[model samples]
Target: MRWIAHIIVNAVLLLALAGYFQSIHLSGIGAALVASFLLSVLNIVVKPVLILLTLPVTVLTFGLFLFVINAITLWLTSWLMGDLFTIDGFGAALFASLAISLFHMVIDAISNND
Candidate 1:
């Protein structure tokens, strides 16, 4: 239930970001949905390993390096999504990741759920 809501929100966010940022291009809401799901899967399967592998950098940066990891996950999602979803470059990915993370933080804070 929560996951579904999260995915839907992420899709909406992706669409909004694409509209606001010239660097992002999403085919449509369907593409956004697919990209959102892909992101969720990668976060589950890849993000933790990335976190582990980059732990030293993460600690050194006072946890800020997690943003780069998030950007990498977004980049991977765009790569896997092919033409349907695209980010112009790593800078765009970083911006999108930061926006997504901020939105999620606010949502979690409001809902008081993990």
Candidate 2:
């Protein structure tokens, strides 16, 4: 239900990112969907541990280090997806994470209004 909608939205956002950046490459909608699912799983499982382990750095950076954590997650997603979904470099991964975050915020806000 809600999770399906979120995954679809994330897939759409991934496609949008591919269109927006030359460095971001998505093989197709299928790859985007797989990447989206993997990203969500990583966020749920790996992100918490990462946030806990990096609490000091995150606190020192005033929570900004979360962005780096997100970028790492994105990079991991790309690595896991291999050729299916590829981000050129750390810069591309960072930018893609920011774009995805912004899109997710907007989507969540819109959904919450309904």
Candidate 3:
């Protein structure tokens, strides 16, 4: 299903980011998978509330504030993951969130995930 594809893609993206960014450290594919799953869960449960709460800022910023919300979610994931998946700080999380968002956007478009 779409969910499986999204998880797999996000895991791959996490691995790729870990490779490219010294600030983001991932233990292995297993960690990536777990992080990916947790991120999916957070997106489903937490992201909506974040979006709603930040609607004014989001709209004011022309929807760019969503990236900040995504960064917060990534930071939360890193916290939940402890040592297995670590991002240096909000800067790294924000960068990773942007990269992940770009990749997901591409994947969604190609797969007609709408």
Candidate 4:
């Protein structure tokens, strides 16, 4: 149930990103759904390892490097998912990551019954 909720949140974030840019097309809701699922899996299974590997930089930057890690994770997600989840460039990936992070906060708040 928690995983399902996470995927739904990702789907919303992806849709939001699409709305932000006129060039990006999501194919359809189903493609967005698949992208969301893939993103969740990538974050869960791949993110921690990447974070740990970059822990030194994370600490050095006073945790700011986490954002970089997040962007990289999203970029890798785009690669893994290919056409379904396209990120046009680094700037797009960075903004998309930040947007998704903010969206996660919203989801967390709502899920916590706040």
Model 1 ranges off by over 4 Å: none
Between prediction 2 and prediction 4, which has the larger lDDT? 2
RMSD (Å) of each candidate, 1 decimal:
1.6, 1.1, 1.7, 1.8
Q: Itemize residue pairs with steric clashes in candidate 2.
A: none
Error of 3 at 110 (Å): 2.3
Tell me the tens digit of each residue's lDDT in model 1 across 14-90: 99999999999999999999999999999999999999999999999999999999999999999999999999999
Which parts of model 2 are misplaced by more than 4 Å?
none
lDDT score, candidate 3: 0.95
Error of 4 at 22 (Å): 3.7
Instruction: For candidate 2, write residues 1-114 as lDDT tens digits.
Output: 888888898899999989988999999999999999999999999999999999999999999889899999999999999999999999999988888788878877987898
Better of 3 and 4 by lDDT: 3
Cα lDDT of model 4 by residue, 56-94, tens digit = 999999988877778887787777776776778877777
Decreasing TM-score order of the candidates: 1, 3, 2, 4
For model 4, the stretches where C-alpha displacement exceeds 4 angstroms are none
lDDT for 2 (candidate 2): 82
lDDT of 4 at 99: 78
